[model samples]
Target: MRVVSLVPSLTEAVAVTAPGLLVAATDWCSHPSDLDVVRVRGTKNPDVPAIVALAPDLVIANEEENREGDLAALRDAGLDVLVTEVRTLEQAFAELERVLVDGCGLARPGWLAEAEAAWRDVRAPSERRTAIVPVWRRPWMVLGRDTFAGDLLARLGVENAYAGHADRYPRIPLEELSAAGADLAVLPDEPYRFTVDDGPEAFPELPSALVSGRHLTWYGPSLAEAPAVLGAALRAARG
Candidate 1:
């Protein structure tokens, strides 16, 4: 199909659904392992001219990741672009369904049904504890308001604790996290691997756990299996 993907999760979808069909992708697009064989075009702010010259039949972008200007430039170049957005677990499923059914011409896998059944296995949640998930390092921000991750946590019966913030991922003082009195501050292990051991030493008062970032955050084919996994983790954490 000569697909060029600027977003990582979409890249994962294309690679998983139709391997070797991808012409290029951002440096961040890594999933299903085999996609590692594809050529790296660049990051989210990819070289548009380079992509245009690739002469792709389909270009995948995200409403959240790439800048509007970048996407507009591609549109101006007359390339067919598909933009996906993921803000909730349901929305994640919808996006994946769109990519598979519309983009790749594949049926939704049975894993989604399995994931739903597994979620049904979960006992009705009784609590909504607070947590702060750190998605990045340097300036130090938490998964705040209006993010897919934040909404996923809410689905698991946990609150962002910083949901009313001005930014989806606002850089906050570390001390403010402690003041939030979160039950746990989850540390994601992709984009940066934060281990459970590092938890005690780093954010002492707040019990912590190392988690797969994509599982909780990436909204694509991965969502087919996420609820079962994340639901289990939340059940365990509350125990």
Candidate 2:
């Protein structure tokens, strides 16, 4: 079955589960680092004509990562599109199953089960900390209510300070974020590459947990290692 994945996590999922199934993927689909496929540009602005020309049996995307108009254009060109919505870890698992087993017509992958088992025993730390999680810097967008990353952090004993905001990813002012009464700042390395020098300095007052964006945000094979990887970062930052 020929498939084209627009979401990076889904691209890795499909590539890892069923190799050679993907005829094309977005430029941002960087996992399985050796992935060799037709690059269809970035997730938000994929080359629609290029994707259509590939003649994939199915095109995969996420409701948040991909644009509606792009998906519609593919569907209009007589291609089957599977759009996924992942707001929490559970949704991630279910959606992964939907994409691989149901959508790609492949048997459930063993890695999916291993990923599930990894998070099965994760219990929140007794003393939870509130954090201001930033996804971007110039406009200062943050994790607001009902986000997959926020849910993952909560499971790991960090609560998002802006979880009550109406917007899923609210663009707050830098000054306001610094004053948000959060115990720390949880910075991921993607959507914006937050590094030791770049991000922590912004929140000078709060301890900065520079975490991997893949483990914190991407829901695929990395889920198996996210807990341990993220937990150590948070611990080191807190100490």
Give the winner by TM-score.
2
User: What C-alpha lDDT values do all the predictions have?
Assistant: 0.75, 0.94
Model 2 segments more than 4 A misplaced? none
The 10-residue segment of model 2 with minimum total lDDT is: 198-207
Provide TM-scores for the models: 0.87, 0.98
lDDT of 2 by residue, 94-198 (tens): 999999999999999999999999899787789999999999988899999999999999999999999999999999999999889998899999989988986
Backbone clash count for every predicted candidate, in the order shown: 0, 0
Tell how far residue 29 is off in model 1, in angstroms: 1.9
Candidate 2, residue 116: Cα displacement in angstroms equals 0.7
